[model samples]
Target: MTEGVPATAGSTRSTSEKTAIFWLLAGVLIPLMNIVGRYRVRGLENVPEAGPFVVAPNHYSNVDPIVIGIGLWKSGRMPRYFAKASLFRIPIVGAILRKAEQIPVERSGNPRDGAGPLRQAQQIAAAGHAVVIYPEGSLTRDPDGWPMRGKYGAVRTALDAGIPLIPAASWGAHLIMPQSTNRLSLFPRKSVDIVFGEPVDLSEFANRPRDSRVLAEATLKLMTAITALVEGLRNEAAPTQRWNPTEHGQTEIGRFNDKR
Candidate 1:
């Protein structure tokens, strides 16, 4: 583990409170969002029942995490997500996030430094809690609509810890809240599909070298799966676009310096 990022304290609330907050939010807001557009969920059962697992998804909007959390919670799981540290610095929201044990990631471009939150995330997952990570590290801006290159920290941490890596796909969140913008407009009642992909086994790398090449391959494979899922979902929204690397300028991965 890198220096200075201490492990988070466990929540004082019982599982009931956690479950209640999750369901109440999902039940109230998810349906309201769905009423605007049909929420077509697939591969939900792909989420594990109990165990340390990584929920790696394409990041498009801030709402992506909320929607992802709701979907996971509905499926009898709740993920402690790695979020921007700045978000956790918010007054009430930050306090809540800190209490909820969410990992606060520093987004500067230093690898050794970036590992702080990731290490904490790995600890959380290793302790038998689901953890959500955005491998891409930021939202995508592909003119042709494709997933960007994913960073290596998420994959490395999951593989090193021997945790299940679950790829996730989300659509329509960008419309609700686009990248680098805070103003949330009333969405067009679009159905945002949140799908979970089958777990990718990285046990081979669990003992293998953590070389740059090895880590990059693992990260790429994971990102490819996520990009494929995202492309599929995007195609559902706009059939004309394809996620082919040649067509899309870049995928949503590796779009930021995720250092603390």
Candidate 2:
């Protein structure tokens, strides 16, 4: 634990709100996470002690959600994610997700359907829970693991809900679960570092019309803050230009060859 971090044990939600499955999963996952990787968390004071807030972190691996979720949990905030709708179709997994009240995101191409997930996220955040939205939408296609161009979903949500948009960064989780494969290397435990930064300043766009240009700029600002935290954790300089899948002829979603 770092200085200035909150000492609260559970999330912002009351004990009665947490479901049995949520606790069961927490019990099994938290201990296992500790066993697999040594974590050093910082900037806990940035997380709000109460009320709704948005956590936007860089996405690089399938394990990121778990790692970030644990980070939020340790910071005394219940983390809710916008998960894929298909995940809700799995047998036991779907049941558990539903019981835990995780929001399902339907990625239908229809622009009309797009608003549904964001609406759900807004509702969740309004209820005083932390909503974790990966601005990159999927794992970074950047060969160096730097965060690529981000989507506007995270920025839009925070702006619509009028909540704090906190930029967070996590480094070294890829060592435990690389983007290339699903294997877990637990023998030699890796060091995973997660840092939370101050809430992004979106006041300029608060009253502006939510046009594409404005939203894109806000997303870039959010991504820039997240990248800075990642740089501090890794002690390395990111590329001058952020990665863009479209420019590189890569699909926005799903796994693709990282090699250029």
| Residues 150-189 of candidate 2: C-alpha lDDT, one tens digit per residue | 9888989988877789999999889988988877778688
- C-alpha TM-score for every candidate: 0.78, 0.91
Error of 2 at 257 (Å): 3.4
Worst 10 residues of 1 by lDDT: 1-10
Model 1, which residues run further than 4 Å from truth?
A: 1-38, 236-260
For residues 51-162, write the lDDT of model 1, one tens digit per residue: 6678888876767777787678667777787777888879988886776778887766566667688779877865777888887666655443356667787787777666
Off by over 4 Å in 2: 1-19, 108-112
